[model samples]
Target: MSTPRHTLAQLCAAVTAAPVLLVAPAAVAAPQAPPPSTVIGGERLGLPGVQVDPLAGAPALPTDLTGESWIVSDATSGDVLASYNPHARLPPASTLKILFADTVLPKFDRNAVHRVADEEIQNIGAGSSLVGIKENLDYRVEDLWRGVFLSSGNDAVHVLSHMNGGIQPTVDEMQSKADALQARDTTVVSPDGYDRDGQLSSAYDLSLFARSGLRNADFRMYCATREAMFPGAVDKNTGQRSSFGIANTDRLLGKYPGLIGVKNGTTTNAGSTFVGAAERDGRTLLVTVMHPASYQRVYDETAELLDWGFASAGKVRPVGRLVEEKQAGGEQPSGQAGGTAGAPPPHPAGAPAGPVAGSAGDDGLGPVGWSAVLVGALVGAGAVVVLRRRTANRAGRLWK
Candidate 1:
């Protein structure tokens, strides 16, 4: 089923706050001004933005974007603030490790040491990113997580999987944990986000996983480190002591304030994927992108969204200016925005509760599984039915 047919206003209210359902005695017809032209790449395109209100007369959303898919979210609340095709599934590549980290971080003792097993390196070869883990070398779980995030180490995933149990069981746990987190559109075929046929995820889910990652101070530290040292030995073959120096690929950090560590991923099939976060003014933003033309688009677009978020302030408005009368279910004055004196300002239309951006679509390459593709649709549809019914029931009781 498609997303539940909530008006933009209703959706914001439902997701962000309860609606005040009193009917207005007189419904004054408010005129809708034609939407303003959108600004794209600093040029007005003359394309009309979606009209959200009549009284407040907010301008159109900027159309500047280069990513095929993206999401920007409030890291603290997991509220998606803006999205573009959020539910679309795409190859997540190494970004899939975000889910892998989520499952592994809580189970392992960060300070506990994991012996790099020969089996952990099984079938993993030179082409795959590695932490230079010499066979039988011991490394702390904390370092492993860093290698996973910072180095994009497939071997680190394998080590964690073995520590968690066999690879199959770790994959199973990854799926279970993703489901529990309400990341329905995500699936893990491999512990590391290697390009496997059945593996896929959406920007929406990555944002969710990134938000969860932020909660772990250890995990956050792993992502932000530009470089780290793991105590390990020399390779016998070359008689060289392999220095395992890892740098985070997430480009947004340091360049952007409140930038936090997430992860970056790319594969022959997946193109490029990124899950990143930044904080400023007590608000944190989660940004995720998949299948972009180049890795830089993910970072550039994310920086742009972060800048937009800072310019806006929480404004409590009068009811007429708060919501569009036509879209207000006939219960509010026309074209008026309203809010209680101390209530948090309601986000505008097109403002999602999670990422400031999100995307889903065919990566213009090949077929993705229908089951994986439908996960978001089914979840959204199902959630709306359940929530709306419960909301209606409660509304009925309050009326009586």
Candidate 2:
């Protein structure tokens, strides 16, 4: 079945207090950012400046680090190695596309085709990036995804957003997806991630989005790809098609060793933002940098963070975890990002295991399940006594 479609403006209209709200963000300077987020990941994460456990001989944190918000975490264990203003809400620019992809990527087959409509491309914000999507041109779902990952194309995003039923519903679903990931700091106002009055995300939330998105095979493939061909306008007379090349906007895609493609974003209000993932020695590290000192620093600082995170190894203790519990849907993690295929989650360090713990009659809910069973057993005993007394009375005999 095909999804119904709605215009991108409809989403903001559904959420926005007034149409006048949109006019000011673009015409004037970005307003002063709101207060820092109330720290969702851990106790130490809420503190300002750099955060790292003091471990003997650990590599020093990058001295030049200047992002307003950032986090580095182990993708498998979900442990946050370190952070700086991790919960600070700021404009995400295109990095929010990661969440958009997380919400909408699984809905359609890659080979499915759609012809662009005049309305689909309507209302992409001013100064928005483009991959040259033209009305009346047909594109495969795979190519559209490439446009999103590689070119950071707003046009491509809108078309897909429409195909998913409409802009309003897509935004709603994206918000729902964010909540599902426990990304408490995100507010989705625009699906293409263009700057808007209420649209925002945190470094922590962005990292979560990247880690969750990495679990999908297709998402991994698209983000890792450096280049792909996009369809050109059809020649009306010849009835032929030509293709144009599009390369990934991420600067570290080819330069950084062991780096996996994630995402990059820049906008007037957001400055520069990025979320990067890399795998080394069966461990994957996720890094997110938002509102760096300059356009270049976002990538440079990200590389430094990645280098420090890899080298820290046993030297630094984890401050907290990205998610404390799994919700069991939409790219559910297999516990370890690099676990042996289908291996169960590793037991907590020093926690009891083996036959003894199992013999305690654990239903995985631990003491809570046992408590319920104990209450049930006592209630059953009482019911048996009451039934015996009632039968004796009815038969004209009594015994206790």
Candidate 3:
């Protein structure tokens, strides 16, 4: 345990030499914008150093992905493996919950109980999904979480908002949390991801949010659950009491080995969106698609990405511990105050210049601030990102 001490001169020389090597690389390849061919929206998009094979045999990817944008990333490393117009604006449907889930998971008190409110059920209007939560009935916080992920209940989201105070306050908190996590391209207008007029998020942004969600151990467990049995309870309203089962909307569970929970979303306008994960051997993959053509499209597209990701060269192997711990401190969710700051400003809302196809952000900033805590819970994001960057390099392509 005794130290091999460095002399004063040795310390000084080590510091000086380190900067020379670090600064030299930057000076040689100054942060210049990428070329036009690589610029899709406005971001520099290319796998600068990924090792990809042009002739690598991959499953036939569907050209007509119903989704306007999609992404597949290595969950362990947060690297994008493949994408389709990932930055294009498309309806997120319930996938919006990924953000809400990330924002609210930190606020959860597993022992705290919550009661469904009348206002929570009011004004959801048409097309809203509900778990049929009885007004004035109380449930454990963990049960509410199941309702949110397994059922995709709009009412459950509203109830969470009520628990956090009110809808506007909850939405505001969610937005603030989003900015803190630095999901810059994401603008949230609803809690349950029911598309409102102004609410929007890019495929890249979803990837970032997914990355954040994977940070929570509790959250990860909830998402992976295929079904849950409701606690015995009676409806306060109409005195109609019943027990209901919550089933996960994600189709990939059990179908794919090593698959875990995240969330799934769909709406008429937003089409179908899915965020799911799987660990094969040790490597994990996070796959997401927004506004897919049909229910099956989400499944097929995700499968394609997973197939390509596993077969890609230099695929990162998952170890016993989570990857963030090896590189950063704890995996902080959206609300955490850790991560690199001075990341420049975010892309202004409606900035006509869009991000490049594979470039993380078109706003000139690199890898927007994300809570490692969130990424850990949603382990898929880290794994996906890790593999994505590697695959991108091989393809001479990159994705946000």
Candidate 4:
């Protein structure tokens, strides 16, 4: 019997040609500096030494989509199923509220009441969305969240930011939360996601924020809610109390089967950006689409991606692993990538072990690259092969 043989050069060439899924180590060191660019290029998207199966028999990716960047992944497993320009930084519009909710929702008591101040609602740009918050009106924290989620109200976001501390401090904390989540592509200059200089996030980062926020019961309920009767404000002069209804901006909810709450945004610069999640047969899938040409296109493209992902779940192989959250104290377990939980067991000598590649350096070719190829024999034999590699060079590591 002939033994299967694979060489470093052969594996390197193959990995360089296609996307490779990576399992992240348990711990990672704190970054010394931010990445030079926010865009996650194709070269850095894949993990070296890992080979994924091609989506040969699955539904084809959407072609007529107008979004500038998009991504679909398994919500539970954090597996990136498909993406296009996943890391291209662009205006996020109101979807940035997901991050805001993640950062501040836990800080305040849901039943706590805060009186709206004129200064807290000041500086909301003209033509921005609002929930009709009035000065001197006391509102429960839960009601404010409903306003923010149901109406995409900038007013609610500003008021909440003020409660947390101030607008600037809330923005800084949100940015820090993004960094801790390993969502390096996000830069938060506005809590409400209104257009501002240097306020941007990528499809990948938006998806990350949504997934993280979903862990909170309040965030999930707010986004999933279709309609709610908001708290009534008492008329300062007339002494009359009035309440109004608000509907979720996310069109996918109730419209798409198995669709749950997420969020949506639109603006002159951002066009339409949406994050959607759906569950089927115990599996949940999340999709993020940004900068669609039209409001309807965001939903359409997201639905298409979700349909493809559900159908392709077991059939299609992963091109890249979603980077996991860095553990506390800045210590990562050695020899594993983002998705892998713990240190990997050592392999025997001369085994078919593949080396994991680090980020690219000055040279165009880094220590490793990944590719997907049809392995007829392996597929026919019902065998999946994982190539493991380890290198000493850590400079410019892909996941900082």
Candidate 5:
């Protein structure tokens, strides 16, 4: 006998009368599979069902980017405006130092001094960049950060990492921090971001790190500094203290109008990677370009992306969400009403529970999903009927 066809009203009534399953919402809302275009190495780079659409009314998205992966996002709202292969994992080079700084920069007092050990300097890879640090020199935390930011100094990263505890512990902590930030594409084997086996990060994750790091005033200052004198050791032969001026490696800082401090990185394997930020007309945009064919291409592409982001901020729709930072214990903030476990706690009375920054789409729903529970419920009954029919049709075909 053919299965009885249920009308939409009947399906709604059936769904309403059915015993409700009391499973946690998270169990029901399993992460959706990302689109095929956003996948790399079988891993989805973006949230499932999220589409990377261009700005609705802005100029066409830049087509000349030579990087393997790139992203442009609103720093204030955390919305990704445009991206290409954002999750493609590649060598991070010095760009990984941003994560290292984010992890350890807050742990020590910038005014405090630490003596550099020979082992710290010795561990840097050959031909790697250095801030000209020397053993037995006591350098202030502030000076070390300058070296790391201005000169892309591997030596400075090691000294700071050593101060945090040890190189290995620092690396471990950085990995932990990346996890907390939901930067799932990052893996840190070296504190200084030198080429190491399995040391990789995606453009999306790198932008996330840069965004988080920028929240710190010191981090912002370090990356924006055009030129600063770095402390150096007193020559034993001459018994005279010397200091060297380090210029910011990020070419976009002073050269690009409205550009601010961030970072840049390059290596034979990594090619060129850059995370940049700019503000125009009170709106700030962040861009990340990874593994461009040439060092200059990173900046050119970044500028193009930033310009697009600034122009499209209010006009363009978001394609994907930058996942929120996870609180300790592996629970994500609940999206349900009444704020269940993992939900953001209620704000004080009269205070605004402002629109959440960094959500996937403009309404927090892409073309594939609903933005709010009320909206979803309005069509829930119809959805149930369609879903049931599809399931039944498949079952009948199997039987035939």
Candidate 6:
């Protein structure tokens, strides 16, 4: 697709119109109620269009940033470093998988095994990315997660959704989980994030999803895994299952300094979307870039924002903060990530020891040769509560 003729001019106009602020950033909250609507964090954040609060000595913010929307924030402090149309709703592509992972990762012990069935894989959307999942194959819970994190496989996502129940159930749960996180800009019409009429998410909401998902250790490990050996079909002659390698789709996983795991997505409808995390000197930053005009620029713009965020760290005041999980419009942990009291242990008997080597096939950038491949969330008492109870009841049958 050709670049839009007026994108640069519009962006420059947005920057020139933004205000310059020098006030110290502060944390604000009203635990007794849902998030305030004025500005979401402060008045500075509410202004229409792109909002960039400049620091006196800090070098200019990236001039070449391109995307429909984007955000950079400090994971620990929740300070929104910078944004442009952060709340604009757009197709999330596979980046929405972060929320899917956050909602489902804590429910099952990684060792739990499930055999894929025909119905489970029957309904995946066409032309979507896939990790080669086939019917009647038995896979550990951890294996399915790797397909998701690495290959961005819709097939793997459908299998996992069936394990949780079914597609509509998982979609409902995802929507409720998004609501609980105050990510109101999202609509969960499809669990695998394949484009649908009503499905959408904003850069702000996607960041919240990534921040929450990163709190879980399993979620963290899977996203950071650059490569892994995925189970292959059983040899009919010997009845022994073989394995093939898969690599994480996230481009920055190894090339970028301090870059941690996250996710990325691309589709004709959504363009390109990505949410990435990195740790530098004990400080972690989260960046989300959605619908960049080109596949490569999505990554380039993200890296640029991250660079600006790190360099401008102490110099700029935060425009907003990522809201905490809430209940009845108040602070609570019932559905919190990595903290659900009744959730299964992070690791059980069959947990993965470590990731494997990179492969020649799909790495989320482009496909190479070779075969092999394949492809969550909650509701009620917040989604986690319902999942916790269900997981407890289903534990006995999990590995059968």
For candidate 4, what's the RMSD?
Answer: 15.3
Q: Rate the local accuracy (lDDT) of all candidates.
A: 0.62, 0.79, 0.63, 0.73, 0.73, 0.75
Each model's TM-score?
0.63, 0.73, 0.65, 0.72, 0.72, 0.73
**Error in Å for residue 58 of model 1:** 6.5
Order of candidates by lDDT, top first?
2, 6, 4, 5, 3, 1
What are the C-alpha RMSDs, in order, of all predicted structures? 19.5, 23.1, 18.5, 15.3, 11.9, 26.1
The residue-by-residue lDDT of candidate 6 on 23-97, one tens digit each, is 111221111211223334444444445666777887578888779888889998888888877877899989888
Per residue, candidate 4 scores C-alpha lDDT tens digits across 210-268 of 88988888888888899999877777799988888888888889989999879999999
Candidate 6 TM-score, C-alpha based: 0.73
Query: Which parts of model 5 have CA positions greater than 4 angstroms off?
Result: 1-56, 235-238, 333-400
Off by over 4 Å in 1: 1-62, 234-242, 315-400
Which parts of model 3 are misplaced by more than 4 Å? 1-66, 232-242, 315-400
Among all windows of 10 consecutive residues in model 2, the one with the lowest summed lDDT is 27-36
Model 1 clashing-pair count: 33
Clashing pairs in 5: 51-319, 77-358, 78-358, 321-360, 334-342
Which residue window of length 10 is worst by lDDT in model 6?
369-378
Please provide, for model 2 over 50-114, each residue's C-alpha lDDT reduced to its tens digit, 9 standing for 90 to 100: 77895999988988888998899999888899998887889999999999999999999999999
Candidate 5 lDDT for residue 218? 92
> How many backbone collisions does model 3 have?
58
Name the top lDDT candidate: 2
